[model samples]
Target: MTTLGNMKVHEITRDYGIDGLSITERNIPSLSARQVLVRLDAVSLNYRDLLIIKGIGRWRPPAGRVPLSDGVGTIVETGSEVQQLTLNDRVAGLFFPNWKEGAVTTEKTHDPLGGPTRDGVLQEYVMFEEDQVVKVPSYLTPAEAATLPCAALTAWNALIEKGKIHPGKTVLIQGTGGVALFAAQFSLISGAQVILLSSSDEKLERARELGISQLINYKKTVNWEKAVLDMTGGKGVDHIVEIVGGNNVDRSISALAPNGLISQIGVIDGLKGEIEISKLMPKEGMVQGVQVGSREMFLRMNQAITLTQLHPVVHKIYPLSAIKEALTELEQGNHYGKICISAERNQ
Candidate 1:
């Protein structure tokens, strides 16, 4: 067991570029009555984290905040009032601590970790209420487990929870990022056909190794929606995991079958766009924006992951000190899957 003491953390010391982040020291936080102290082993980067770090989004945190929402750690100490978890239990912090189950509401969605609200898990040690963390899948390393809290859960919610994807249903996944790949994986797990679109042919080929036969290179075919229509025999896909938020939504609408669902999860291609209402209206399709997911959904997803023995695609790993380089890599958008930060190196 590692000795617990003061911890080193990277904080957004200013609202600027990656250079705004500073590594500093802080005393390990004391646990409250229902809280537990955890030693973070790994943290994963998300597009949202990049937006938050750059102060580019609506949910920008104040300066001096620790920024990141996905991480896994082992409990080193538990408060007397905590009963659900024990020392040495491995768990990942929830993005939205208040969202335990059922439908999301304003109150439940208010406190997102490592953002405009709460502190994230980029530090070596963190204090969270026992309920704010979920057990990591036993088969996964802490780095792999760190990818689940955000990317994996968002894909699961979009495809299984709201999209109601099933066998024979066709799911269209945009890009080959963390969520997109997980969407493909989970869709395949449900016996659904996955048609993944990426600008890079190499990424498309990588998706093929994961059992995705239908791949589309958007760079090669600009009107990829037509390709989708042609591939589905002019019917279009049942679900489209829409990651590109610009005018691409209009294209997604064009590629949807009747009563199909478009799980709008990202805006990587530019935030503002004009939706073709005329095209969307005729299909009677639904476009639902998905937040990561609730704790209940995370638990359910973990159960499925354990049963399937699914492994997340880890594109790269970096030490905590290489946060700027990691963020730069994410900004370039060249990686095929999740990028992780290992706190063990810092320790």
Candidate 2:
């Protein structure tokens, strides 16, 4: 185990922007009676991080806030009252610390990590209440494990928890970003066929290498909904991981089979638009907005990942010092999977 010492942390010191993020040195935090200190190895980027950085959404952080939700680390110290966690245990922080299990509630959703509410894990070391962390899968690298708490968990909640994807079902995944790719991987693990849509043929080809043969170039096929219907023999898909918001919702509804599920995970397209209620009414389709997930769901997903040896697709890794560059890469939206930040010096 590495020796613990003073830590360096990135804080949003100025107005909302990548430039506002500044790294500062601070003393290692004191452990509370129920808190455990962890040495973060890697942290993964999410679209939500970008939104928080830009102050684009409701969850904007105050100045000097640490800014990332998902990270994997090793426990270096534990308080006297901490019984569930021990030194050297590998774990990741939960996105929602209070919501350990069960259905989502207003109170549980209020204090998510990495935003305006609570400080996130974008530091070399962090402290968490013993119940706020989960063990990482043994087979995963820190980078892979870091990707699980947000993007991967969101996909798991949307597909496995809500969509109930299974054999013979067709899942429509939009874009080749983190959540979409995770959804595709989880769907394949559940024996479902995946039809991945991307603007770039190059990106789609890369996805094909991951066993997704059914590809739709949305740029080539302007009416991609028609293409989806054609591919399903006009029956449409069983589930749509709807990342694009706005009028894309209408198209997603159009591309669903009878009683299909649409897991609305992102709002890249825009926030508000006319929903074609007349179109959505006949299919009896269901649309559910996905927040990341509960800690219980994260534990269940980790068990499956460990059992299947499912690896997260990390497109690129940047040093913690290059966080601005990493956020730029994420904003460009060209990556095929999760963009990660490694705090490991050797990496």
Candidate 3:
């Protein structure tokens, strides 16, 4: 196995100036008895990673390597106790970093890789517990599967697990971020009608080509909630993937039909705020927070992905050296979907 050390990573020094990210060489991580060492082929950035860089997320790495929660790689070595995985297994890191199976808890969610507390996958090599890694589908390359750990799993949990949406149900996905985009694709593959909302009509139009039944340009229609209501002929959507959390909560709640579920997946709109819960009371609407997903969820998502050959929509790719530029593009919201970093290309 390659003992990768003195590797450069995008270190976030401060919150205000993203340019504060400096490339620094650090030691390659070592594997535990139950761990596997992977040479990461690709990594994808998520909105949560941005929040951590911006100093808004719950936790932050005190020192050491910069953090990234999701990446895909080939295992180069397996620990003595690791039986399920072997060298050369194409795998993605678990979202929780530590949580392996069963139910999720505050303890399980405490330290996510690439979040505040854990060092992320931005480095060339990473060590993972064999149980915390899930093999990617054979249909997906490293770059495509790299986007799955966060966006795909969250979308799956939101629509299928929390919302319990079926074929005939109408699903509404807000924003064109990675999660929403994945939700749109997953909804379509499930034979559900997907209404995609985005500020840019051009992006919405692009989603149309991917089996999106309805598109709402929220910028053009200021009251997009009314448009959502109008589309369902006042019945509203059966499932709403709510990415922007704050004041938009009531609107998402309002746009749901009776007993309709809202997957509160993110706080991209406003992090600290209050929502009017009374509106949801009338419809008995349920809003469940989705913090990515579990390993089991990833397995389920992969099965669905392989069955449909559903690949993630990658908007742009950046070589590893241009990570800062790629992150800047993401911060500016220039890309429509996931931004991938090719590690081997730059290596």
Candidate 4:
């Protein structure tokens, strides 16, 4: 097996802000039985990383924690008892490693990577249990594979696995970020109509390039809900990818068709939200919060990706040294797709 003597890790300081982020050195850890070592190639940023870095609410972590969730890399070494995974395998760690399959439980959601609960894969090397990581679609680049763990999988769990949406369904997609784009692509494959909402006409035009023609610039159209209803013949949409949380949720409910499902997966507006019960009750609308997904779900998503050759939209790739700049870009929110951090020297 090859050896990495020491590796650089981005860590959080007591300040818990961008200023608190720093680079540090640590010796490579030894592997135990049933464990394998991955030389992480890239890590993709999500809005959740910002929440954790800024110490928002329950996302606050102790000083010296690594903060990142989505990563993809090649296995470099395997422990004696590690049978399922072998060297040179390309894999990404599960967001919720303990939850392999089945429904959500408090215990399953209790601890997640890149948070206060456990250290994330911001470093060059990460060790995982044999089953904690899953192979990704071979057709995707490392950066694209890195985007799957959270955003992409959350989209799949919401619209496909849980929503069970099919052809002829009208899906209202919010924003143009990672989750939104993934939802849009998945909706296209399922033959569902997508009415994407964005404040910028430029981003909406970009979505149109992806073959999603129905678009609305919320900045110009103050009440895009009416547009959604109008496009659906006053019946409202069948599904809503509610990436904008908080009071906007009520707006989503207003645009829901009878028995429609709205997947609450983002907190761009705010963490706290209130819905109009009267509007939802009459429509029989349902709001389901998606917490990523299990390893089993990841496997299934990979299969679909491989079959369709659907690539995750990647806006830009920054080297590890520019993590702060990447995070700042994410805060500015102009990017149309996922922002990624690559550990490769050439990047």
Candidate 2 lands at a TM-score of 0.97
Model 1, 96-155: lDDT tens digits are 999999999989989899987788998989899889999989889888999999999999
Q: Which regions of candidate 3 deviate over 4 angstroms?
A: 1-6, 14-16, 57-59, 345-347
> TM-score per candidate, in order?
0.97, 0.97, 0.94, 0.98
The predicted structure with the larger TM-score, 3 or 4, is 4
How much does candidate 3 score in TM-score?
A: 0.94
Please give the TM-score that candidate 4 achieves against the real structure: 0.98
Q: What is the per-residue lDDT of model 4 for residues 211-246, given as tens digits with 9 covering 90 to 100?
A: 999999998999999999999999999999999899
Task: Flag clash pairs in model 2.
Answer: none
Q: RMSD in angstroms, all models?
A: 1.8, 1.9, 1.9, 1.4
Sort by TM-score, top down from the best: 4, 1, 2, 3
Poorest lDDT segment (10 consecutive residues) of candidate 3: 56-65
Report the error of model 2 at residue 315, Å.
Answer: 0.3
Instruction: Kindly give the number of clashing pairs for every candidate.
Output: 0, 0, 7, 0
Best by lDDT: 4
What is the lDDT, from 0 to 100, of the residue 166 in candidate 4? 87
Clashes of 3: 7
Give candidate 4's error at residue 316 in angstroms: 0.6
